[model samples]
Target: SNLETETEKLIQIVLIGQPELDQLLKKNELRQLRQRITISWELLPLNRDETRGYIQHRINVALGKGRVQFSRSAVELIYKYSHGIPRMINVLADRSLLIAYTMNTKKITPKIVRPAVKDVGGLNPLTTWIDSLWKTILPGFLALSILLFGANYLMLPDFNKKNVEEKDLNLIIKENPIIPKNLIISNSQAPIIDLPQSGNLALEKMKPVTPSHQAYTPDDSLTTKLLNPRRIPSTKPLIIS
Candidate 1:
């Protein structure tokens, strides 16, 4: 009667376990009481696109619905550094926010994200390894490349011609590689005038010309000059009485 009642009121039970537990169960060292059941769903890490939302969610929680912005570059860097793990994202985000706050910054820039990721522990080992590759290995690699290039350059055979005699060398030293197109050669053209020789040859533009003085005195007879020039005869009005 109890078995019949249990069958009539059967409740669906779900179990969640990791791959190691499954392996143990298969080895018979560990066993599920109900035996074989279906594996329905597999959860995977959040992807890069999802990680942005995840970070925003955590940041929203932290800010109590206030507005604090994350630069797009900062978000991309966080995604790359965290590899889309929620826990690592949380750690990096928290550290980054703390860093930004301590630095009195309002937005999370890429510069802030990089330092925060480096400082945060529990980040994926691969991410840390890649970061280290950039920090330590890259400079060394660049130096090695430069060294190799220099060595290759040095090893090549010298193709230089033999040095000329002293007289020839002197002549070569005095000789200009480029001939002046406008040399003052004796010709029909007038001989160039001797320019005023000085360390500072004053350019035509540099000479300062004195400005013309303007007489701007106000005339006392301004009103009469405009209309009626009321002039008095200078010779006592020619008193011919």
Candidate 2:
């Protein structure tokens, strides 16, 4: 390949394909074709702001003017549905223009953009709802599933396991004490005692009693102070309300 004649002209070839198809062409298969190629480039779509500028530039070039009128909201809608791709933007912009023209709109507006989006079969609401549902529902469902799985794994018996002996099928059950419903705290036939005429047992109990005489003892350890006790201070008798 390096011993080419001076009269022969060297030609280079460029190949392009989608990201998915790139792996189909192996370096070994294209060795001869790509022998002279020293560089390769990968291009990505523009972002929302960049897409807006891109659409405006295309519109300006097509109309032979510095600017083409597009409402802010309309531009945003276009960017949202187009996903900031140049070719997708062109397609949506063309469709939107057609819709605007038919609807007698001088400049593209959000109202025009909506119908245009719907007409061209834009994003599906059901699919969007499903996506949102997956984001919100799936995680919570999975968490609950995980918790249940862990609990079952920890608490429940494994049916497939062979560790348990078939001969010992009876499991030990705990027995609780049984209480009789008819049991009573006291004997039913027990006689009731009558209250005193005063009907105040606490008052009767609190009443001070007269001091009785203590037996005489000649013990030196027992002083007269011990034999004769100090007088207790009198308190008002309690009156039941």
Candidate 3:
């Protein structure tokens, strides 16, 4: 004011400060100064995409072709917490990078940024709520998912084994039309036979059958059917003892 009064040439005065300066000048005591101000321009905060580009630009200038990078999630968190203020962005970004460095990682993520935000303090209620939500909810959800996956993985083999056993049982029943009532198929035991004495004559006429990995001694009823000297496939031979 003194300089302008002395010069009498309408000197221009520029006030550059944080947004708080606007509220400061709006106070009752500063009404005269506020009214006398010739012009006022407030710098708007950067938006989400602009904040990303700004951060990337700074990183590129500092690192050149370095491998260090910020994940999109981390950038989003930074934008949320800083509300696109450049100085706050710098603070959060720097802290996040430092946190990542301590953890021996070149990439900054929301996990790293969360801790950095806490360490820097001055978080708004919404940001704090989000931080708490992630800290508590995300881990529990992931753990549940992993547990469910593990349970499903563990149960799959048993289900497949049961199906295979059933299929094997059905195939055995289909291939051998006459199965003894006492014949039992189990994992630990092979098929058993209860032969009757009525088909001894037919058994003697039957040729000595080839051995196989799966050999079943048939009932007297099956021995009667073998009396007809028909061609049997070698792969699916009926063994009788």
- Every candidate's CA RMSD: 24.1, 16.4, 17.0
Could you give the candidate ranking by lDDT, starting with the highest? Answer: 3, 2, 1
- Of the two candidates 1 and 2, the one with more favorable lDDT, higher being better, is 2
User: What local lDDT score does residue 214 receive in model 1, on the 0 to 100 scale?
Assistant: 50
Over the stretch 151-227, how does candidate 3's per-residue lDDT look in tens digits? Answer: 99987666566677767776787789796644533334333444444445767776756578757666766766655
lDDT score for residue 131 of model 1: 78
Where does candidate 2 stray beyond 4 Å? 1-38, 64-67, 122-241
The estimated TM-scores of all candidates read: 0.40, 0.44, 0.44
Can you write out model 1's per-residue Cα lDDT over 135-163, one digit (the tens) per residue?
A: 99999999999999999889986555653
Tell me how candidate 1 scores on lDDT: 0.66
lDDT, candidate 1, residue 5? 61
| Winning model by lDDT | 3
Q: 94-205, model 2: which lDDT tens digit per residue?
A: 8888887787756888888888778878553223467889999999999999999999999987676566554344332213325443442343343434334442343355
lDDT score, residue 166, model 1?
27
lDDT (CA) per prediction = 0.66, 0.67, 0.80
Off by over 4 Å in 3: 4-13, 63-67, 125-241
Candidate 2's C-alpha lDDT? 0.67
| lDDT, candidate 2, at 237 | 36
Error of model 2, residue 17, in angstroms: 5.2
Our tally of clashes for model 1 stands at 0
Q: Candidate 1 — which pairs collide?
A: none
